[model samples]
Target: MDWQAHARTLAAQIVRPESRWFEPLATTPRHTLVPRWWDSVDGQWALQDGARDPGRWLDVVYSDRTLVTRVGPVHADAAAPGTVVDGLPTSSSTLPGLVVQMFQHAVIDDDTSQVLVTTGSGYGTALACQRLGEQRVTSIDIDPNLVATARERMNLLRLRPDMKVCDVTGKLPGAYDRIVSTVSVRPVPASWLALLRPGGRLFTTIAGTGLIVTADKTEDGGAVGRVTPDPAGFMRTRQADDYDNPTREVWEKAQHADGDSVSVSRYPLLYVPDSWAVMSMLALDVPGIDHRVHEDGDQRTVWMLHPDGSWARATSGGFLEGPTVHQGGPRRLWDALERIRNRLNREGQLPVYGARVTIAPDGETTLSRGGWTVTL
Candidate 1:
């Protein structure tokens, strides 16, 4: 397979003809960065080796989709074939289109601007290098192994950028004209504001939701901006070996408990993650609801679990029918979801998108729109 040709074709499909990113996307060898990755199969993460299946590898690599390179602490390169690990994706090469879109959001127009971006597969870093010279680009990741491997892969392509292993939430390596994070965070890190030059811009999504915030540094050690109309979701930044796994006891209970309250849902069963606006609002309001869905023939079960011992389970016979909900613990998880859905139905759109975003020096974030305000 002609991987270069395929990449060019993908670039044409994803980027506009007049975009500066067109050439970068067309030339970058994504296959080299993700020669081995994890693919979900039968509810298990199976290792996919590119060298073993060149055709399948070329197709996935050139396509505009995310490839999981690490699950928990297990890098796909070290996993044996037929190996299956059931865990969350810890690292990945983000979709090419999204990466380009984020770069566009960062407004990297000047060749002199020093840009700092999160390094996952190093694919985005490579693109940045192609657009703005390698001297002006710096990529950082929390995992040392990922940073080293990314540097090695970029070296193979003869595209070198400063790659460092450091927690992005902490002090940055250097001052930059722009900081674009593909990873999400709860509160906007104060270090980011400190590292930015006076007019420096930052782009990132809120953790666990599809809220993309584009802000510029202020003189008062704060930043002010509005959420983008387009939605984006990224994995949360982690300083440890891996993210904390949800408690097994809570999941087991939520799976088979009658709960403290039971009633028929007024609205049909809905998955929060399916709708960008709805999910963003819920994440801002409730903060940390873990969502799961199980389907058996015509029966569907949806669950929302919070770390605070709150869980809600909704079950329905068919797609159009309302679900019978069971809730337990302190917060009524299902009711909260329903209220958001009700607002969506009445207002025709959630007020989250394009809302005013303000981040104080102390890391307090407030989103205000139409008299509704949420502080994070």
Candidate 2:
């Protein structure tokens, strides 16, 4: 396969030729790091091995797409042929465009050294190694198998980063000038602050939202920056072997079942997840609510459920039309969503996207813009 040519084409689309990331993205063999991956088909994971069909493999690896490397606790490389599983994705080789985009937000420079980055499929770390040199990169993952597998695969590309098994939210391996994570995190981890040099920076997305946060470390062991214009989402940082899904009870309680109060919405039915601004704001104002959608022909229903037994169900004749909303539990979730949507309609925008972020040493984050402020 003419991998170099394809890589160049991909790099052109992902990054400008003059950008430092261009050469790295164009040269790194992503296929080497992700030999096999999972694809969701009919609500189950179907494994695809690159070795079996080199042609399709090259196309997939070279394209701007994410490859799921692990689902539940199953790594695609170790899964047997004809393997199918029902589980949420645990890890993936992030799409190349977003990888470079997140790195660009970190603004890694020649003076920056000893960078700490997440090691998922090792593709991102490989790009870092290609750009900053392996000696300056320290990559980590909580899963030992992922750490070992990523280390070996990267070695095939003649790149060997210092990969380790460590939860990014806990004590880190070493101090560094820059840290970038492809995984989404709730509170910006305090360990990142403890290890970051005073003048260094870190970039990551908040879990359950598409907000990309970039902050520069302060002299007093804190950091302050803004939510960049770009948006992204990744798997939450898992401390254990796999991710825990939203409970079935939340779904059962919310899905199709009527609620304590029912009424028609003032506005059109909007799936909160599809709108980054709405979702980010909703997540900030009311945390821990799981959003789900059910569709049948022209009719669709959206569910919002929280661990505390709060739930909102909205059914629409069509996705774009006003919905008949039902709310129950400790709080009215659909009401909160309606307020956010109302604010969007009234003010024309939400502050969640471009809000300035201030992080304390303990990882408590405060976001403020205009007169709106929220903390996580």
List, residue by residue over 304-367, the lDDT tens digit for candidate 2: 9888889999989975678999898889999999899889999998888888999998899999
lDDT of each: 0.90, 0.89
Among all windows of 10 consecutive residues in model 2, the one with the lowest summed lDDT is 241-250
Tell me how candidate 2 scores on lDDT.
Answer: 0.89
What would the per-residue lDDT of candidate 1 be over residues 270-334, giving only the tens digit for each residue?
98899899889889888888999999999999899998889999999987888999999899988
Candidate 2: C-alpha RMSD to true structure equals 1.3
Q: Output the worst ten-in-a-row residue range by lDDT, candidate 1.
A: 241-250
For each candidate in turn, the TM-score is: 0.98, 0.97
